[model samples]
Target: MLERDSPTPLYEQVEALIKKNILNKTWPKGKKIPTEAELMKKFGVSRGTLKRAISNLQKNGYLVQRQGLGTFVQADIEIPLERGLYSFAEYFQAHHIDYSNKILSAKIPKKTSKVIADKLGITINDKYLCLRRLREVEGENIMLIENNINISSAPHIETADFSKESLFSIIERYSKETVEYSETKYSAVGANSEVSSYFSIKKGAPILYQEQLVHLSNNSIIEFARVWIKSNHFTLKTILHRK
Candidate 1:
C-alpha cells in the first residue's frame, strides 16, 4: 500500500517496489511483468503514475518493453567503468559473473601503423603483439576486444593464453609495473560485417566502441585497446564524486 500523505512521489515508490522485486528474484529475467492494468489496480494508482514507474525502470536497464508484447525483466550485463585500472576479466571474476573468452588471433605484426604506434608511444617500426578476443556470457557474444601491447614491455605476451588470463595482470607480472590510470573514449558506431557476424546481429546494428590507452605508474604507455560491445546486451555504468 502506498502512503498517500508521504512526501515521496507515488511513481517513485512504485518504481522502488518493482525494482526490489526484480533484485529479489520475485520477477525473474525474461519473464513478463504484470500488465499495466493489473499493476495500476494493485497499487491503487492512476494509469499515468503506473506508466511513469515502468518507464523509469526501463530507462535504468531493469526492464525491456517489446512491441505488441509486455515489459519483461532485462537480462543484460552491466559493466562498471569507474574501477580505475581494473580489467574486464578482473571485474567479472570479482562479481562472480560467468564469463569466457575466445582468442581469435594473437600475433606480432611485421608492420606497425602510425596511429597505433603513437598511442603506444613507440616508433612506427616498433614490433608489438596484437591480440583479438571475443568475450561471452551466458552463451552470448557481448564484446570483441583488440589489444596492442609493446613487446618490450611485455615479453612473450604473444604466447600467453589470453583466453584464461587477464592482459593487465600479465603485463604487471612481467614488467613489474603497476597501471596508474587510463584515458578512455567512448562512442557509438554501426557494426560492420565482421562485427555483425561476431555478435550475430544485423549489419549496421548499434555498437558501443571504447578506445583506451593504459599507462604505467611511471607515465609510460604500455597498452592500447579498441573494444566493440553489443549495445543491447551490455550497459556501461560509472559513478562520479564531487571534489
Candidate 2:
C-alpha cells in the first residue's frame, strides 16, 4: 500500500509502483505500457502525478516514449543494483567490464588553492599531484575527474596511469590502504568551458558535481576527488531502510 502520510511524494509513489511492475516482469521490456489515462485510473493518481512519474522513469532509462504513440519499457535498460558507495574499480570489477580512459594532465601543482588545501589537509603552498582524467565506459566519455593528491603522501604518482587505472586502487596498492567510507556532497551547477568539453556538452549546461573525501580504515586520508558527471549519463538509485 502507498503511504499517504510519508514524506515521499505521491508521484514518486506512482513511479515506484510502475517500476516495481517492470522489475517483476509483469510489464516486460519492449511491451508498450498503459496509456496515461489507463495508468491514471489504475493507480488512482492525478494526471499530473502520472506524467511526472513517467518523465522520471524515462529520464532514468527505464522507459522510452514515442511521439504520437505511447511509452514502452526500454530493451537495453538492465535493472540497476541497489545504490551505495562503491569505488570506481569496484564498479567495473563487479560488472566484469573493462573501460578506457584518457590522461588529460598529470602534474605537481605548487600553489594549492584554499579548497584543495582543505580537502587534502595541506598547506596552501604545498605541492601536489593535480591529476586530471577523462573516464569512458564502452567508448563513451561519461565522467571527468580533477583530483589533488598530496605529494608527500603519494610519492609514486609519476608511475600511475590514472587514465586506465583507478586512483583508489593505485593508492591502496602502493600505499597499502583500504578506503572504508567517504564524505560526499552533491549539487547541480552549470558546466564551465573546460568541464563541458570533455563530455561534448555545451557550456552552462547543468551537470552533477560530486565532491568526495575518502578515508582509510587506519584513519588516514586516501584520496580527494571532484567528479563532474553529465547529468543524463548516470542515474543514482538508492534504497532507504526504515528502522
Each prediction's RMSD over C-alphas, in Å, is 10.0, 10.5
Candidate 1 residue-wise lDDT at 69: 84
Error (Å) of candidate 1 at residue 213 is 0.2
- Give Cα-based local distance difference scores for all models: 0.86, 0.75
Q: Given candidate 1, what's the lDDT at residue 126?
A: 88
Instruction: Pick the TM-score winner.
Output: 1
What TM-score quantifies how close candidate 2 is to the native fold?
0.64
* 121: Cα error in model 1, Å: 0.9
**Stretches of candidate 1 exceeding 4 Å from the true structure:** 1-74
lDDT of 2 by residue, 1-243 (tens): 578789999999999999998999899977899999999889888899899999888756578776677888865312234565676656776776556778788988757789888887877887778788787654446678877676566578667877666677777676676667888878899999988777677899888898888777777665688999766636565666799
Model 1 clashing residue pairs (backbone): none
| Cα lDDT, model 2, residue 15 | 94
Q: Predict model 2's lDDT versus the native.
A: 0.75
Supply candidate 1's per-residue lDDT for 220: 87
